[model samples]
Target: MTVALVTGATQGLGLALVEGLAQRLDPTDTVYLTGRDMNRVMTAVESMPGGGAEVRGELLDVADHQAAQRLAQQIRERHGGIDIVFGNAVMRVGPDDDPRVIADQYTEVNNFGTTRLLRAFAPLLRDNGRLLVVASSLGTLHHLAPVLHDRFTTPSSLDEIDEQIARWRDELKDRRTGAWPAFVNIPSKIGQVAAVRVLAAERREDDLHRGILIASVCPGMINTPTSALWWNVSTAPTPAQAAVALLDLALDPVKPEHHGELVRFGEVVPFS
Candidate 1:
């Protein structure tokens, strides 16, 4: 039986992802939808249409490392391994938000959270499995200053990524924002993509032998509570529409060229 998991699946793009998976996966396939709130998670699962994949709501806070580990272990015990994982949990902060809060929230929920999920579930991916981290077009290399490109594109180790985040935090403390991207989300998403690249590199042998694909995806602009926090979404695609591309990426067979790259609509986006 196919087993899949979507983080932050209670609402918006995440919720849409679970719904899409439900519609597409077979009845015997199982999909775990996770959120920080158990009530909301169950509610979302109950709201899904019947006669699709077996949907289960799970209480998961991607920012909580132990919580992620426990859930991964539970899934491993029950299902042997997961076939798909969509890293959809994220935090969005704007200029009006406190810099201190922004630094902490964005790093904890967006950047490191992606790292936590990868660490927790990556090894449990079955052969020919797929893992897609839902990043954004805003994470493009052009969004960052030239000097920072090499650091993100070179695929640093997870510990090195942590150090880079620490360095960013220090820069924020010193009020040296000029060296970083204008918005914290850019660097945060970049870190997510970088982490994916690192995992892909670390698992090169697995990619060749097992046909596993791990990459970050940009879902494009969508009308979601998260995007509404930043810009006008009146004309943006609905969450369901955006979820189409993401689900396509997650369900498609491994494409050797696309592994480790940041992709949108089946195309590789330049990292630098």
Candidate 2:
């Protein structure tokens, strides 16, 4: 069976991903629903209609290295290696609610949490298996390559800078958020594209060690508990809609042509 593991599977895009995957994957396939909150996890599983029995939620804070690492190890022991891994767990410190809390909190959940989850789940990924991280358009490297060049401690090249700009704008053209357009749709948007590029550079090799086809994905701006819903309320797709596209990218057994790339709706947009 093609087993899938998605961290932060309780609410918003993560919850949508779990539900969508359960529908797409075979009935007998194992789908693990994970989140930091047990109550949220349990509640999410219970709401899955007939599939609740097949859907099981585990308590996991992907940011907690030891705990998350242990969970990954347990998956290896119980289910061998994961066939599909979705690094969908994220921590957005602020959604403009309080800009002051944004820095530390954003770094903790969005940045540090991303690295930690990728590190923990790297070994759980199977050869030729696809892994997708639920990232934001703001995190695209194209946006930050120039602004953060010096701060990131990476030397910059003109080609790299031009590429970053072109790619960033191209990736942004699809919508405010690359894929979701609601939950994570940040005004001035967070640099999800940038984060994905960073992760691809640092974690691509890390993922390759496990034979995983990894790519970071922008789910667009999904309107969740942490977004500006009132300001922009047009044709907003649900988490379920976003999940469908994300699953398509994550399940494709293609080559590294798009590996370590940022994709949305089966299309690849340059980030690095």
Candidate 3:
């Protein structure tokens, strides 16, 4: 049976994705909805219209590396491998927030957390597996410092990307002003996009075994509790509208040229 997993599926864009994906999957297929809170997970599963039997719920906190590993093991044992993975989990820290604290949590959850999940699940992706990382336009290169913008857009070795992340963390910890607080989400999102490129390249360089497509996409400004706090929620697109593009990426036929690229408004755009 085909198995698909959606991280941070409790509400907003993630929840919309789960519903859209569940409706399309075959009766025998399973779509797992995951979040950090079990109550939310259960509630989301129960609330889906028509009560999708194929949809299930699990507790997953992307920031918790051990939990990711454990969940990966469970999926490996139970399903052998997964067909699709929508890395929809994300965090935004703003308002009444300490620069250091918000920066730390944002980096931990958005950048490190995503990469950790990818590493944990890479082995468990079956041939031709697809991964879609839910990214944001706010994380664009122009939002980053010049050097970092170059690194992210031009594509660099994973080690170099790690160095950049370390530098960012240090800058935040040292309380360096200017770029630190203004562009909090850029580093992690940039790292995630870079990670997608790295993964795609690795798959290409390795001996032809299985075809795994890795890609990151920015769903534009979506109206969600998270975005409401960060931006003018009134002007943002509905979660359903944003989710359509994401769902299209998740379900569409894989195109090799599109692999490792960042999609915006359903089109491939320059990383910069």
Candidate 4:
């Protein structure tokens, strides 16, 4: 059976992804809907159209190392391996949030949280499995300083990417030479996209040849609660619309040109 996992799926695009996957995947396939809160996960599962027979809520807090590892172990022991992994969990640091707290939370959840999922579940991904991390267009490489962009796009390894995140966070917290609090999400998202690119490149010879596809995806300016809270409302697509694009990436046959690329609006975009 095709076993899929979607993290931070209690609401917004993540929740919509669960429904979309259920509708498209084989009837017997299982979709693991996960969130940091069990109450929300259970409520989401209960509200699905089929009462979620094909979906099960799994609690996961991407920033919690032990929680992530435990979930990975549980999935490995229960299902043998994972076929599709959607790293959808994220933390939004707005302009009003404290700079120190913003640096701490955004880096921990958006940057490290995504890496945690990839590192832990990557091993459990069966041949032909797909890994997609949710990124934002604002986080594109061009949005970063040249040096930072270069570091992200051409990282030698995942460790290098992590180091870059650490350095960026340090700068963010620095008064003399630091980033603005409003732009906290950009670095974290950039780090995520870069890490995915590095991983896709690193695993290409062995994993890609064996049918594994790893890449980062941008869902566009989705009209969710998170968006409304942070930015001016616009004619952005609903969470369901964004989910359609993400589910397509998750289930469609992988194209060589799409591997290691940032997929935005359902097309492969230049990483830089």
Put down candidate 3 lDDT per residue, 6-122, tens digits, no spaces: 998989888998898888778788899999999989999998885443998999998885888999899898889898899988876666677576766677777777877878787
Candidate 2 — which residues are off by over 4 angstroms? Answer: 51-53, 93-96, 145-147, 150-211, 229-231
lDDT of 3 at 219: 86
lDDT of 1: 0.86
What is the per-residue lDDT of model 2 for residues 1-272, given as tens digits with 9 covering 90 to 100?
67787888888888887887887777778788998889988999988865522677888886564767888888888888878878777665444444332434444455456656666676566776776777655544345435444432241322343343334344444443333233332422334344445555665665566556777777775656555433362456678877877877776566556676767667777544
Q: Estimated TM-score per prediction? A: 0.95, 0.75, 0.89, 0.93
Residue pairs that clash (backbone atoms under 3 angstroms), model 1: none
Which tens-of-lDDT digit does each residue in 207-233 have in candidate 1?
A: 758888888999889986667878899
- For residues 216-254, write the lDDT of model 4, one tens digit per residue: 999988887668878765788899988888888888887
Q: What overall lDDT goes with each candidate model?
A: 0.86, 0.63, 0.77, 0.82
The per-prediction CA RMSD against the true structure, in angstroms, equals: 1.5, 7.8, 2.5, 1.9
Candidate 3 displacement at residue 107 in angstroms: 1.4
Q: Rank the candidates by TM-score, best first.
A: 1, 4, 3, 2
State, as a TM-score between 0 and 1, how close model 1 is to the true structure: 0.95
For model 1, the run of ten residues with the poorest summed lDDT: 92-101
